[model samples]
Target: MSTEEPATPQLQSTVSKPPKVFSCVLCAQRKVKCDRKQPCSNCIKAGVSCTPGAPPKPRSRRRRVIETDVAARLQRYEELLRRHGIKLDELDDPVISARPGVASASVDGANSSHISAVVGKDGLPLYAPNNLWSTLSDEILDASSDDERDLAIRVANQSLDSEPSTPPKIELELFDLDTPLPDLSSLHPEPLQIFRLWQTFLDNVHPLTKLIHAPSIQQEISRASGSPQTFTKPMHALMFSIYSCSIASMRDEDCMEILGEDRALAHRRFAGIAKKALTVAGLLTTRDTMVLQAFVLFLLSIRNVYDAQDLWILTGVAVRLTERLGLNHEPLLDSLSVFNAEYGRRIVWQIAILDGHTAGRARIDTSRTLYRGDTKFPLNVNDADLDINMRERPQEHPGVTEMVFCLIRCEFGSQLHNQAAIEGNNMLRLLGNPSTPVAEKETFISKLERIFEEKYVKHCDPAIPLQLLAMVMVKVMFGRLRLAARHPRRFRDRGATMSQEEKDSLFAICLMMIEYDNQGHRLPGMHKFMWHVKANFQLDAFVYILNELRHSSVGDRADQAWREILECFEHHSDVLTDTKNPLHVAIGNLALKSWGARESMLAHLGQTLPDGEVPRPISVLRSQRSVGVSPGSYSSVSDQRVAGEPTQNQAFQVANPTPFDSMDSTPIDWEYWNELINASGIMIDETQYQQPVYDARAMNDWK
Candidate 1:
């Protein structure tokens, strides 16, 4: 018990102790256990650049020692089990669920192998590579915002209408008076052949009648697997072919082809094609397609292949696309500006003149001297001049009517801005003529007036104000208001030589537009409409209309137009009222009031109105008297109509009420007024319609 063991002394090593190994950065940052399997356990744990400490030399399991005791026991057990009733192959292999947190135990532990990677929802192998799978997963999981969707749509839109690999071939058909002559003056026989080929091409294509019924081929191509640009190509090509056909129709198609072919019937065939093509092309909302179509239309117009109608249709296509896609885009405006500047004004004027011709119920004399090249007011036509009679004589041309229709469609229905400027002036110039005949002038003025007061007022946006003003000016010119007010001395000095009725009429028209404000008289839509009209039609035509209305002479178109307008207004007074157009109603009432007051004109107006109801002008005056008065005062009061009213010559004085007299009159009596006030109530104003006449005048002066 007391014996002690000998103590051993500590031995010092010559080398210093080895430094501690650090974990790999990845594992250390995460504070997770690492295999440390690379160069060292620490390196594997950190997920750092790990390399095998040495080459991965395969180990021979065969060389390892066998557990003979366990092996012998297992083999003996298996042999005894097999004799009892069990087979070694009968045991089923174990499987693990794909979901994590499943059982770890496996029945076949004797045979172990690593599991294969998993597949993802999008059918891609998600577990194959860590780097690639994460990116794919993030994209698949993230939702797209509204702006992203729009961006994608825009990207698709921008790609449509790229030029085809082939040089965009076209086959133009010719019909009687339809084919377009090559710009080259040289006559050729091949053009006719080309025209026939164009017709044949259209028949084969079986052009679309409506956009909703796009051909099966076209629909299929758009949906095919290709870029949007490629998809829209067939449509664009079809449209171009149609345009070519329209151009051909204008040529002398019936003229024997250089090869002796009669292609007069080609026009109808090609027109059909053009219509279908336009319908298909319009389905596209992409910027590139819109611009291309606009450019093509412009070229056709300049080349005289397409008339005003064609230009109008083409313009509609461009404007609709631009609006649908959003006009703020730079390319759209750039293209529109070019089209607007080049022939824009001319097209507008043409439409205005067309409106004048048909609505005014007069022959629009394009032959009248718009200008003489040597004169200060040059009668020269601009490049934009789409005048139907520019190179032709005064012979009645059927094309003139067509051209007018074209102008109307283009200006009124398509490019509204152009229509406002041109159509307004053309209407006024035609209506203001002294010799225009009252019947014709009245019809024209009435139609023109409705478009502004009724149509434009309700839809005030766009260039409606300009249109409204134009209508107003034409109305005044028909009545000779501007000329009489500005140059009263001319009427007084030449009273005996010229027609006094014509002078008086012009003055009356002017008075209606020149409302008493803080300032002197002014013309509505005059400056702006004139600016555009003068830029295209003969500048003097505008000045001349004013001058003619002022001077009053025999055979004066202004005089003729004034009479025509008054007569028509008297005829359609009731129908005009339903329009609920304030301007039209006001003018109608004034015209009727003047006529009913005159013994001579009363008979004329009586014949115009429905079976004997007092004219509106007389009715309005009576209403004003009883506006706020007793109810019984609303009676017909036939007594006042018979005695108080002045004759036709004196009738004009109502509009010329002295400033003091007008101020003395009380505001309209709302209670006593029934039908008159009722009519006014139904009228919807396009503009605020609240500015005092003076304010509009001041702005006019400043301008």
Candidate 2:
């Protein structure tokens, strides 16, 4: 081994290994860790790309945060300027424009040794003021005053125009949002036009701007107010009011920023404008008084000063105002009335909903349940669907008359004749038993009857009229309608249809009832009918009744129906929390099973079958069918035989004799079983029950 056989090469151990680290191009350039991937973390942070194993580059040194004497001194001056409402940004750069306190001298005089000889005590040359040019100084002074006034007027004008255009302009970004408070002087450079420019600026800016530019605006405003300039002209006062209104509506936040956060300060500013509007309103002639009453009321309402009294005052003035103005309608008063009425109705409903005590039990929950479950069936009425939106009167807004009707139906037990008599008698008595025409009395009864009839009548909608009638009946008959009153007779009678004209007349009456309730804004027991009917009745007949109620022009039951219908479908119950009301599970099951289709055949039966014939299944079913003769012919002899001694066996027997009967010489009772099965609608496999020992009644007892 020691033999120097080609001297053994010195062995050296060497290891090939993977690179220890990788880097992205950006990270390497920044001299930071790479954590290299396709896009390394460092690269991603820098929003650049990475390349693995790239050689790192040296990073440039960062600039130092050194302070210069000039910058430090300038910042101090800017801070001081900010405190005095003089923005440093307003200053010129490179000292081109004259500084406030600096003075400029004539150019030729500046270089004259003789002029320079006129020296001050400190050896600085004495210089006359720029205004030393007597004529030019006067002109310049006059121009400056005119400019300030112009800006002021412009600001005021802008404030006036801002009211109506503010919301939309702000929304559309028509103006500079970042620069809400623009420098009026910059916007209008002419010194003489400054006042008008300021007025425009004020008008365009928020009323709160007064707090920021208080010194300037207040000074001008005070000067304007003190001067003999009287806004006695109607146009001037009106313009002033318009401006004031716009100012009143400025954003509270913006106002708070200018004025202290104390609302009293804002209120003080608002009071000035509010008084202006009130003054304008009072100063206007009868006709013009209500020109901006809507806006006035709106402002007052927001200010917490508006009330029913103010509403009435404005509305009262409006009656004569429109007439005097020669306007066809008092839109102002109309708008006021509508607004007040809506708010009033909402208030009434809120109170009603909150009131814990009432004579009648709260029927909303039970009604909802019944409507959701049992009500899906069509009432002999028409087109009632699970989606309540299809109904005529919303459950919540049943008209007073309809509310009266709902209670009546529930109270009188759907007995139209009996209830009609009682209601008519009561109404007659209420009319002081005066002979107010037989038709009026009859009309009243008919109204009551229509209300009840709708609950169980074909194609009838349970509208305001019906609900009102129901409510009335409920009141009259106490809490429960005498079940006996619904005695079999009422359900069986199928009556003739009313003429179109008559239906229209009834619809008109319903509308009147709704209006009445709306005006009163308080009808006892009436609203509950709306809530209950909406909550309860789901039968097609209910909708039909509502639609029919709408036949009359006066029946404004659509809204009531719309709301109730919406609630029925849209108002969901929490399945977990609503234990007593397993409405969700039940509704889900029903929806799954029926696919939203109603089994409304029963409702039709309620409308069709006569009261006494309610128990007869054939009568119930046949009422909805067309009346005509059957296809078979029967002889008098066969009829006689069928009438006499027609036992169950003979009742089911076929006319012709069969081979099986002949083989027995005794009639088999199989025919009875067959007839029973047919009547019961149950199919029996002959092969399965052919033992001939099947009990017919037991087998088809479902009947």
Candidate 3:
């Protein structure tokens, strides 16, 4: 039994075979020991999910090969520089010899001594300060060949061209030496009339502008009106501009009429007086804040009346004057009265906002001229709390007011304008270098979407002022529209492939903008100038809907969207008669044409009308349907496009139900209509549809 020897005790392997190597994949990759468990100790300690797998293969080592040619070339260059008594280190040290005469040889005595010992120079150190050639030697050597030097110069020139240049200063003579201030006594309304106009201005225009301090202005007007005191030209101008804007904003026709004169003509006369005073008084050179405020008021009064080009120039001049007064710079807190400083800040920010807004509309770049720096935003305090000596902190929980809303709008516009400028520059760079990676463009777009979400989308509170709400909506929609415009083909392709949720979001944004515009007009103290502000936003929405209809694959959805846009336009038809707002009128006319064309197309498709007539005017149909519904009622357009129901035209009859129906006899020129449709980029088979009969009466009224 002993000889059997327990099967001759197989020699126990002394080497413990490398302990299984059963660590999780992550631990193994990191070369850390892991306890063999479902979730290994290392993974649990590291707070990572345990993923166990077989040991990973070791990565092969890559051999590093030195470039012999490059090393030899650099050695030879260093040797050559040394032979010429030029040390490479000396040429490379920009801090030592940055200029012609100043050179920092050493930071300390010991270093200075070491440098002197190494270079065999006493006190002179390694390099002299007066040697300008030391810095240029490397460049000179590198650019030895003529072609190389030419290339260097060309690259330098390209860099210079790419860099933004400072704009030249504009100097304009403020005073007319020959022309005197116009006698404004004849133009000035009576004292009672002035008081009434001032009250109207306070109610309608002052809330929006807020450029003037009401207390100061009221006191000035009272003192000036009390006696036969001679007022300064600028004061008179300010009063006239304020009154003119007041009268212009009055909705009542009789209230607007002054001294039995046409309201618009009377305002124009008052504005002319203000202009003459500004010129004769040399207000530009005076850099008077009151005069500037008056000028801005005058501009507001004539916004819809003047050519856009003239307005743009005038605004630019005002901005330059503001900058000249140092208003663009934040006032030192201790240097001026709190009221004066705060007012100055408000005026500058207001001008900057106006400048950016106008520049955007004009499609011009004024960012270079518009100073946007560390200027403080005005405190969100009401005028009553602000006085000459007292500085009031804005309430932590301030209620929404006209001033507060305007400030919010101004801030939003500023940020949006800056973003647009940045994106524009990036796009230009991409255009210049077509090889930019697609991932970079995608990242840029993602960032823009994030910005929109954070800035505009997140701040949509119903309690905010309607003007502010509309402005925010417009900013968001415009940003998206512009992004789409940049890649029209891509956008179209994406729209074609978009899911139902995405399409709904697009439609919802368009619908929301239209709805907001309609809602804004209903608010009390809503100014006419708001129409100018919302005009582009409304038109952009219209364009967005049209684009969707033109490109969407879903016919039913497109029809529903088109019907909604038509209904929105029909509801706001009064805008067509607003002669003062040409932009609104133009948009209204386009909507009318689009609606009429759609109705004609449906009629041509043999869709039965409600009255069983093939060719009744759209106005008559709209009036019949709107007879019972409230003007502000929001009916979903999709509901109207029922699957089995007759087309939208079937809902109306030939009963003349609208003011527009009286003008239906005037025929629209078919050629012009076709041009408008084509210009809009909507592809349609015109031959399949008859030219819609234009109301001669409406056309005459439009003309």
Each candidate structure's TM-score, on Cα atoms with residue i matched to residue i, is 0.22, 0.17, 0.53
- Give the C-alpha miss distance for residue 236 in model 1, angstroms: 12
How do all the candidates rank in terms of lDDT, highest first? 3, 1, 2
RMSD of 3: 33.1
Which runs of model 2 end up more than 4 angstroms from their true locations?
1-244, 258-265, 276-305, 329-703
Model 2 TM-score (2 dp): 0.17
Per-structure clash totals for the candidates: 54, 100, 6
Off by over 4 Å in 1: 1-278, 284-320, 324-655, 658-703
lDDT for model 2 = 0.27
lDDT tens readout by residue for model 3, 1-703: 8867765555344353345546777776677777778898888888989987685689955322234224424644554565365644567578534544323233232332122122311132222111001111122212224453333233223323233211122123234544434566555667777777888777667766678888777877777664313667778778878876876676547554545667766766676666776675577677677788877787777664554334556788877877787776554432657777777777766666555444433323343434454456566666676666676544622444446455554554344334435467533243212234434644554555566455444555555454455455444434343333232122212234434433444444554555555555555544444533433335445554543432231234344455456555554553433222223323433333344444443444456433343222245433422322221121222212222222333212111111110011222222222222222222221111111111122222111
Global Cα lDDT for candidate 1: 0.30
Which candidate achieves the best lDDT against the true structure?
Answer: 3
Best TM-score goes to which candidate?
Answer: 3
Rank candidates by TM-score, best first.
3, 1, 2
lDDT of each: 0.30, 0.27, 0.47
Q: For residues 1-703, what per-residue lDDT tens digits would candidate 2 score against the true structure?
A: 6686445453222234445666654565567766667777666666754666645568955322132223323533543454354534345664634344322222231222111112222233323211011001111101124443232223223323223211111011111232122221122113322343235334432121111212333354445443313323332333333333333443345345443344444444444443343444443352332233323332322222222222223333333333343322223223333323222222222112111111011111111111010011001111111122232322332223212322222223123323434455533132222224424544554465455445434332334444333333332221112111111111111112323333223323332322332422234434322322222222222222233211110111332322232233332222112212212222222221111111122132232212322222222212322212221210111111100121233211212111110011211122222222221212221111101111122222111
